[model samples]
Target: MGVAKKSIEEIVQAIGGKENINKASHCVTRLRFSLKDESVVDTETLEEVDLVKGSFSANGQYQVIIGQGTVDKAYKVLLEVTGLQESSKAEVKDEANEKLNPFQKLVKLLGDIFIPILPAIVTAGLLLGLNNILIGEGVFYDGKSVIDVHTQWKGFSEIVNLIANTAFTFLPGLIGWSAVKRFGGSPLLGIVLGLMLIHPNLMNANEALQQDVLPQWDLFGLGVNQIGYQGQVLPVLFAAWLLAFLEKWLRKIVPDSIQLLVVAPVALLVTGFAAFIFIGPVMLTVGTAVTDGVMAIFGNLGGAAGFIYAGINSLLVVTGMHHPFIALDLQLIAAVGMTYLWPVRVMSNIAQGSAALAMMFVTKKKTLKGTALTSSISAFLGVTEPAMFGINIRFKFPFVFAMIGAAFAGMIVAMNNVEGTIGIGGLPAFLNISPNFWSVYFLATVMAIVIPFILTLVYAKVKHKDL
Candidate 1:
């Protein structure tokens, strides 16, 4: 219990104490501290605090990257020990506006855009896995494939699909809603806009691209393609931002007497035209280019790309900026039938779990050990933030070891050419794996876990006199 408190106090003191602090806030895995002055920050000492995985300055704030679950505890203590009032994320953002570089602002924007729809995405992923599990030749507890052996269960399966499809099929609408709300527009309006993008009359974006379904509308005087953004991500997010801008401007220009009637209508018409004409087509190109680049790296560079991907995947998880890549994953699956990223994701998640578990055995501190055990389980279950920020990350060696573990796992997976056909990753995501590649994936998972655990355990024993 006191371990977290002790850690929080050390964190506060090492960051130049209460007087240097201007504001403090936190996200899923980082304690965001806005210091009155950055020069006073003791980065060296902050690193030495065993509870802190690492510290870095970003977005005009001195962000101490901590993991989930335990972060909440540390945050409360951060306020209490510093004797400072807790601050809202918005307040912290406003004060630290000067601190945010373009990259940091982009990161913050991504967090805003994705956080709202993350649950839906994760749920959709799990549902995808569940659907795969229930229908496959390797279906848990049965030897039957859904199509061949479980034909009678088609009715039940359709119901399952209905439940599953709700999120993924209408993903654009969901993203639209989330993005619109994030941009300070009416959430309902955003959702309505989103659903409108997928109206039955319009041609689906994927279908139009594939030419399997013909376009319903071609612009009268221009050659621009017109299609609905069904599963397209960037188009909708960009659309939401554009919608907010238009809506706000309309509110300013339109009179109150007829504002309700004309404002939404004009905003949607102009925004929709812009979206279908330019934003949708342009971002779709960007998405394609990114997908090609990621695939080329993995395809051409092999193990090197794997090593890089696996290592950075953990860091991306740190900042909650992994959402953008979800679009890439979808594209990869569409292009190559399997995404190389999922295998690395599995390695990153499992290795963190392994390191946290290793910490449990080697650390003499009871609270950290207990937290390690709990967080390790959480990591294994596909939530890495707790194990990462709390245990593996705090003990710097564990995080490094986990990175090493991910690198080696990536190498093995790449060499084996492991891939997943679905938009899922982490532990049970292997459940979504096709039958032929299971053995290779199993070995990669083992490598990811065992290597990091042993390395971190050895480092702990060599360094800790208490152990």
Candidate 2:
């Protein structure tokens, strides 16, 4: 038989056909599709198609790994040839209405409530960590030493320092306002709830409760713990949303004569107490349980978890799942008081950066060399996508070596129980280390750089048969 000429339709038909394509999704550099059966697909011919980078199966799904800047075109071509429009349209619609979806709406609400305030929180955490370092070094007398510049700055620095140092002090108020905003409730109500948590009388009551010097509740049966909501999530947000709904419903039923005063008080009182007594505690318990479970896993896995974290993290960055993980880490820090994630992440970034640097060094092709150089710089600055998609994953061997190196180094760091004092990680982490851990921190940072360099060098030599 002579060579067969095939139209796009025929080509698509030969490769499992459009009908066999069950579902499809795209990330930064791949068109991931779920097919009815892998046997129906023609992988060899599909790889030969122009603009196709590579193809593979992962997570029980057939994936066509396109290169950067080509996934959209590939997806469009697939859509046209397959005559599949419904799933694509639904995806678009979902993207558009993501903020309105229940789970997504809550997430968005929480994000909006928390993100604007995150800089302040991170600053507070840094200040606290720095203070600890100072005290440990005998540079400061105590956590509250007025002589400390971090606490005693006269003018502008004083204002900035106050804001940073006082976050935990004012957390309840901040959380309350954010929660109210998130739930479309009265901001004043949130302020009131927050005040109850932070008031001196409440603190005294809490102390009394702790000592068992007083009964759990007064005449109102409101316990001290029930009202102490600071650095807390879930409960306050849920309560605020519940209040918003109740307020609106109550307004609908009240008579126009005394609607303003009567309905408002009743709604606020009912929702506030219910939230304080029931919803707040319930959500607090759930949040605490989640934190405990995560801590347990991390504690159990110890160093080995670092290797798994590093390997999977590189894959996540390559495939665009890394952003969600970043969000989760930030939330974990906020909710759980600290994190063990940054060291592994720092190693992974350095590994990818080193791989890009290696490619720049070895490649004779000017285009590849230039791409690698630029991506390497970006990776150093903590933007790893270009390096990951453009240089590392495209080369394959470098990416694998980078991940392996990262895992090894990350495991070593985790095994030492090394903790990052600062909220940020990656290259910036260098500036954020506590003075007490300076030696360990410096060693970890250097290892992050060195491990990847050596691994990439070895891999490049093995692959190209030349150093």
Candidate 3:
């Protein structure tokens, strides 16, 4: 997967050289550059660079499309040659915010905050799936949970559950750490600050809501309610960013003599109190409203929502906005024990693959046919970027058919009331499928694959002969 040094140098030269770049970053499938001047970029020459599948300008960044299989190799080379500091997607969001509208910026912020902590949540989700298999009724224990038949394994199961529950249980701390890290503050201090929000001494927010037992605290003549921040998103993100902003400000103004001791403690106390009295309640309410609103749209509209969502899902992927939905899907799973969003993702990926496969079969040029074959194979294996920028989107018409395939299949799944279990939204979803929905899921997936393949293949056949 190592890209040639010459190719890396060529890519760097083609993007108006290192001097024209403000910052450099990488997502799962693209090397993103924030250039000082967009006009200096030679798009034609850059696309000709070896190992560079494609390039495009979006959200104020010049993004060179790199395949997932070789992105790391190429990203490292770009970093070395450009001497650009390594940065996370969150950091890049800030660098590229000039091109985003206010709403897009807000969504980017949420995605940036959550993306850093996703590995933990995703690992926990997989563990939850494993736990469900053992303890869920009629799953793997022959009509009884595994622990019921084998009492000796109860402690082991408890340990596993504990491991599985850690991320959700202490979500605030992870969010805090990630937010501060994004803000260029010490992640450790932010984590400590976050843990304080969910301290055991405070009344559990969710439990209090469920049982109607919120204990009120009086502070500064205000009746403040105690609410633990576990399993909460907005509170921690706000608090962490607040802490970082305050700490940075204080460090600038505070005398150097007493800075270290005074800066951290004062920042923590002020930020923590502000979070409790202001940000926590406000963010909680906002999060609830947004979640409820989205749920309502999906609930009332059903198939229409699914059609729109699945249809545009690939476009989101291409623009790198899809990362935001990772948290949204997890939130849905938390709320309803499953998600409709993820199953459609599987369909979208299959549709993309189908389009790529169709292009491979119909292209007259042997070179393009080989490229399409590689991308299609990767797409089928649950990596769609190759099929996307590398084949379908590049061909133009195939991408359209892919979206159509996803939309119709998504509508079908929604009409059948298909419910997807909690898991990664790709192939691993099969392991987490809800009972009785497997056949519906499979048939819908087949529809996604077949429709795009046939439509795109027909179009390509006529176009290739003309070519």
Candidate 4:
């Protein structure tokens, strides 16, 4: 028999529905629920519903993984059935209650693990990318200037660079903390391991190896390379997780009398060496492979590639898969000195932003109108989360039209050979275009904005009646 199509009311009842749900939200792939209490709902029963992908309780909230398009549908049903609205109140609840939803739990966990460290990353990336641009443009002599690095006017640049460089410098530490949290270990120990990797002596040794100078350094007959381990990913994170797992097992075997000293030393030594020899290389290789594949595909496609790339890229951003691709693109730009992805990315962001703006003008609901307004502004600032999650995903057809509009603009830009030299993409990426092609770049940027804006307005006008 076909699975029963549970009405919103029945599904709500199964999941401990109330006259009004206190808060509701979603993650990349889950419809998260924070109800008054867990005892009222039958989570297992809710999972049996046809529309529900899967349901589970984690942290403190009930999470229903509803896939991509389904999350918006489920969110709509939730809002309609429960007569509840999303707002700031939903985000300020007790940690215990917040954890009930797996999406919320993951967000909280990732936040706790990464938020303290993100400033450094953002700063480093901005500085490094900007530095490359300045140096390329001959704005600074030999990529260093008293004014560029130390002056008061350069405070913004210095702060950003410091953050980026520091983050990269202590990357292992960041990974260690995240890995420890992921593996349920003592996060501090992971950070300690990260610090150990970036020690000065180790960095000096790595420099020697790069010069093919064999240094007289051996521990247990294994040659040690002094490599600077800042700004690196993969290895430290893998090592931290590996150490956490080993520590968990060792704790069971070692007697309490000497467990602390013996188990910790063994776990750290084994994991640290493993990271240097195996995990780091493996991660680097994977990142390289993914980047190479994307580049190869993009290179082979030529002028027409932008259409498919822009359309799919917009969809990925809306679905939260854009980050991985963006990460790879940035790495490629850093390594190869050019990028093809930014033209498409910039167009897509503006397209979505324009769509949100259009939605603001047409939507009668004050709540949605406000959300659209905020989201559109956020997108202009290169923060698309508000636009994608708050407006585009909910309004549906507007996003589709936006993608179509972006693809059209992107194709024209690509055909004109519009490219960005900088690592950062989005609206700001226009500044990174080569001056020789400024005329073409300006046209591309205008097209990116206008095409999407016009299409979005037309789509919203036509679709408004249906909605």
Candidate 5:
């Protein structure tokens, strides 16, 4: 307790004391602080502190890296000693955004809105992967799926398919709920708007394309397509923003006595009409175009696209710009059956893991060896921040070697056109790969792992003998 307290106190002082801290929060493995003055931070001293694994500023927050189990303890002690109430992640993010430029703030806003919805999306992805395994022909048995081999379990496979598809089927609701809350409006209203978009009365989005004439609402001799926004992301996001803006604006002008009765209906009615007429059609086209354009570029570039994306992905992770890609991956999956980006992302992750693993074998320092070993394992499990920020990036050359390995693996992924579901990555990522591409993806993954390990270990030993 005494040791922990001292470490927490030093961390506070090193970041220019408790007075400099505007808001503070913790996420998985780091203490994120929005400070009054970043220039006052003594990063070197903070990194030297016993409990702090490392420290860096990114996403408008000064993040002090600490191991998972220890970060909670440190955060608790920090709040107690500083006499600052523990801030919610959102609150801290808002405070952090005060320091960012307009572009950075916009990116951070998207990250904030989408992150809360990832759990549902990720769970859906895993379940989808499971469904793929069970129903995918030639995956388990030769030319037959588990259900095909055992007709008795056909009902079971059907149920799994139903459950796995729920999130994507009603993605607008998920995005609307999160985006509205992030924009500072009533979440329930956002949900209502989302539900209205995909109401059972409206024609299903997927089925509408097949019909010669879409179901339409005759509004004073004008025809409007009564189509649902199922699986659509951008339209939902825009609708949510408009809903929040309308709700806030209504609340301000409407008399408080009648506000409760008047505001909800007025806001919903206006937004619903606007969404059906303007936002939904326009943003859906925009979203489809964006996804199609991205795929076309990747298809045109083929291996070069993979090489470029994988090579620079680690740098994106470093700057904390990678969060928005989660939304993009999700978008691509919704537009198309699968995303090619995810396979390359997995390759990049394991390459960094392999590089860190290499350091464990070559480094003389016990602390460095331990960090490399554990972080490498973590990276293989799909979380690469520790390995990238803690081990590979810190050493410089290891990161370069990791990128080189990633580029090679990415080329293989692109040439073969490997594709997978979103949100699943690293070694267990094979489960998410399209069943047909499993063998080739595995081969590419092996190269991702081996090439980096060999390169980092060999280069470090030959060039930097001081270690």
Candidate 6:
């Protein structure tokens, strides 16, 4: 642990030392610091630290991406070196909140609400990808899917399909529970609100869209539509926020003696009515418009859209703004059959991975080469933070070369109209791609990898000899 300890000390020194660190915490993959002075931090030196995958300032904190299974270790060492005790994530977030702008706060809130639910979504995605293989044409048999060729697997395929779709079908429930928790409300009450939105008594959101008229209840001489929000985003998010706001305010005013008895029912009843009458319809309309607008823009731009998204994806990752796109992917999948953006994102991950790997060969420094090898492999496995922040972005040229490769690959993705379900990125992510387009997608993935690796190596050799 001596070498590891030294590296941790380096991280502390680079971040303007213990004096600058007001508080520190770690999430799944990053060491988040509430710093007294962020400008004093040495970004280049911080990036060069052995265990640091990348570093950036966002959401009112300086975050160092250290990769999973390793960040915890680093965080522990960080605490030891800084002579600071561990702080809860919420505590650290509170420490940093005053530094955030409204927009940054909103992005941070969305990230907090969504990040917890990713494991469930990723599991469903992997299962969905498997189900796609079972039903997809041209994958296992000549001109036919495995289930089509063999009748015995039909029931199994259906079971897989059912399980794979559960998260999406009940997405509002998941979001409601998470969003309410983030908003400082009772999570169980949020779950109840979510269930109320998708109750069997109401018309399913998808089926309701197909009908010209929706069933309604006459309340105070006004018709309130009895429609369910099954796989929606914006509506539930707004509803959850409203529920939390009401619950918290009710607690403050109500006498503590009877607060428990009065709060839950009153909050739920009022929020329920408000959701069905005002919040649901309005936000659903907004969500639909946003999804349609995005699809229309991408559809019109075609290859150009892919080029731009892929080219700038790494930059967005740095700013932590990419978190919203996960919600957008879910919205797109609900509105349309698939999300086109995910495939391009996967290509970007691959390009970052390959570009980092090129440094393993071009650079003579053993520490950098070691970092490049491990981080490259990490990037290829669907996490690019280390590759992007640690190596490529640190060096400058590799980052640009990676983006160039990603742009070309993303163009191919758009030109072919490739689409994929939400899943992990990098090599394993190809499973999420539409099986019909597997051959072409494979070609694009190759270009995403090969172009960056070769270009980075050649550029270093010819242009930057000392690199």
What local lDDT does model 4 show for residue 416?
66
Which candidate, 1 or 3, has the higher lDDT? Answer: 3
Which is the winner by lDDT between candidate 3 and candidate 4?
3
Candidate 5, residues 213-310, lDDT tens digits: the string is 88788989988899887787888899899889989999999989999998889888989999998898898788778888879878888789889888
What's each prediction's TM-score? 0.84, 0.62, 0.83, 0.64, 0.93, 0.95
Candidate 5 ranges beyond 4 A from true positions: 1-6, 9-20, 39-45, 76-88, 206-212
Lowest-scoring 10 consecutive residues by lDDT in candidate 5?
202-211
What are the candidates' C-alpha RMSDs? 3.8, 8.2, 4.0, 9.4, 2.2, 2.0
Which pairs of residues collide in candidate 1?
Answer: 53-393, 60-99, 67-389, 68-385
lDDT string, candidate 3, 132-221, tens digits? 656666655556887788789788888887998888778778878988988877888889988998999987665665765577788978
Task: Report lDDT (Cα) of residue 225, candidate 2.
Answer: 52
Model 6 earns a TM-score of 0.95
Assess each prediction's global lDDT (C-alpha) against the native: 0.76, 0.62, 0.78, 0.63, 0.86, 0.89
Instruction: For candidate 2, write residues 352-457 as lDDT tens digits.
Output: 8888888887877676677678778777776676677666776687788778877877777666656553344456654344444556656766776777677776
Per-structure clash totals for the candidates: 4, 0, 0, 14, 0, 0
Instruction: Candidate 6: give the clashing pairs.
Output: none
Better of 2 and 5 by lDDT: 5
lDDT of 6 at 336: 78
Model 6 C-alpha lDDT per residue in residues 157-223, reported as the tens digit of each score:
9999899899988888899999999999999988888888988899987688788989999999999
Ten residues in sequence with the least summed lDDT for candidate 3 = 421-430
Model 4: per-residue Cα lDDT over 1-467, one tens digit each: 22233555666788776542556777766677666676777755765565554455545656665556666676766676677776332362453444345655544544455545555554555566564444343334554554555456466655655654565556667768766866777788888888876776664322432466644447688775445454454456567779999899899999999997988899888887787666755765665576577676667664578888777776664433454443444445533545677766677777778788887888786766776787787676666656665567655776777787778767766666665543344566555555445466567667666766677777777767543
Best by lDDT: 6
Off by over 4 Å in 6: 3-10, 27-30, 47-54, 65-81
